[model samples]
Target: MEGLDPRAFVLGCSAIGAGLAMIAGIGPGIGQGFAAGKGAEAVGRQPEARGTITSTMLLGCAVAESTGIYGLVVAMILLFANPLVGKIAG
Candidate 1:
């Protein structure tokens, strides 16, 4: 890496970091899906409680989705406004 440009290296590493940050989305997705499925099952078992179950499920899903949204925001920042790239003394 003797001839490697620092700015280019930082940019490349930021891209990789952005990709890894995106991986954080998978857990939230899976959790939200599972919560929805269980919520549906719960509502099916007690139709009268559908309103409560639905509302609770939606809230949980929203909370779970926030993590994925955060990951997406981090990835976007890394890709678009990468602070590390500016730190390189080019």
Candidate 2:
């Protein structure tokens, strides 16, 4: 039997890794959107609380953004440093 080409196998692994990495974005996107809506509603209900609401909302957004950042890091690793490629090569 013939063996698989290293380059083709590596490219396929990279594609799968990229797809898996992007899946992480789902959490942050939904969480941030929900936070934004809640912030808008909070400001609507109590205009005087705008300062506090905005601060809290921003903090929530920052936390939520971490997931997206993690996803980006994974994607970068998959595209650039693909550890699986090393294992396959070895």
Which candidate tops TM-score?
1
Compared with the true structure, what per-residue lDDT tens digits does model 2 show for residues 1-90? 269798777878798989899999999999999999999999999999999999999999999999899999999988888777767645
In the predicted model 1, the residue pairs found to clash are: none
Model 1 regions lying over 4 Å from their true place: none
Q: The CA-based lDDT of model 1 is what?
A: 0.93
The ten-residue window of minimal lDDT in model 2 covers 81-90
In model 2, which residue pairs have backbone atoms overlapping below 3 Å?
none
Per-residue lDDT, model 2, residue 70, is 91
Q: Estimate each model's TM-score.
A: 0.90, 0.86
Across 47-89, the per-residue lDDT of candidate 1 in tens digits comes to 9999999999999999999989999999999999898877877
